[model samples]
Target: MTFEAELRKGNFQVAECTNCKKTVWPPSDFCNQCFKEIHWRKCANEGKIIEFSKQNNYYFCLVEFENTIKVIGKISSGIPNKDQHVRIKRCGMTDDNYFFEFSLI
Candidate 1:
């Protein structure tokens, strides 16, 4: 299945270049570097919190997965710290944007 299709099912997938073995961010059908075809694979569930901010009662953070894909998601519970490890608790499309919820690992 495609990226959007899989994401809609709460499965996070990444696009990787088959020839160069490099991950392509933003999920493309073709690799940006070699212009080769891409293959879809499940992304690592765990990520490191790059940065975070508190809004109202919730904490939102920028998390990096596989050292390549960075996404903004909300903390499911507890206060987050820099470079803290987190796991994807929930993810799916929200209207036109993607939404992710993370929990400390």
Candidate 2:
């Protein structure tokens, strides 16, 4: 399945190179390194918070998944801390931009 298509349906997906077996970030049709075809698969539901900040009452964090994909998402509830594990609460396209919400695990 295509990354954007699955993402729009609230299913997170990652692309891996068929030849190099390397994960591709930014969801491409081909691997950036070896230029091989990519295969799409479901990404890990859980990720680690790399960094976080509060804007007003909402917390936003940079989360890393499978040690490759990094996405910025908002904390759905509770306070967030660095290195905390989080799971995807919601994800979809909003307007032309991607939006993600996470809950602390």
Cα lDDT computed for each candidate against the true fold: 0.96, 0.93
lDDT of 2 by residue, 46-78 (tens): 999999999989999999998889999999999
Point out where model 1 deviates above 4 Å: none
lDDT tens digits by residue: candidate 1, 8-99 = 99999999999999999988999999999999999999999999999999999999999999999999999999999999999999987899
* Candidate no. 1 TM-score: 0.97
The runs of at least 3 residues in candidate 2 whose Cα sits more than 4 Å from the true structure, single-residue gaps closed, are none
- Distance from true position, residue 27, model 2, in Å? 1.1
Q: What is the TM-score of each candidate against the true structure?
A: 0.97, 0.96
Per candidate, the number of residue pairs that clash is 0, 0
Q: How many Å off is the CA of 80 in candidate 2?
A: 0.5
RMSD of each: 1.0, 1.2
Q: Give the TM-score of candidate 2.
A: 0.96
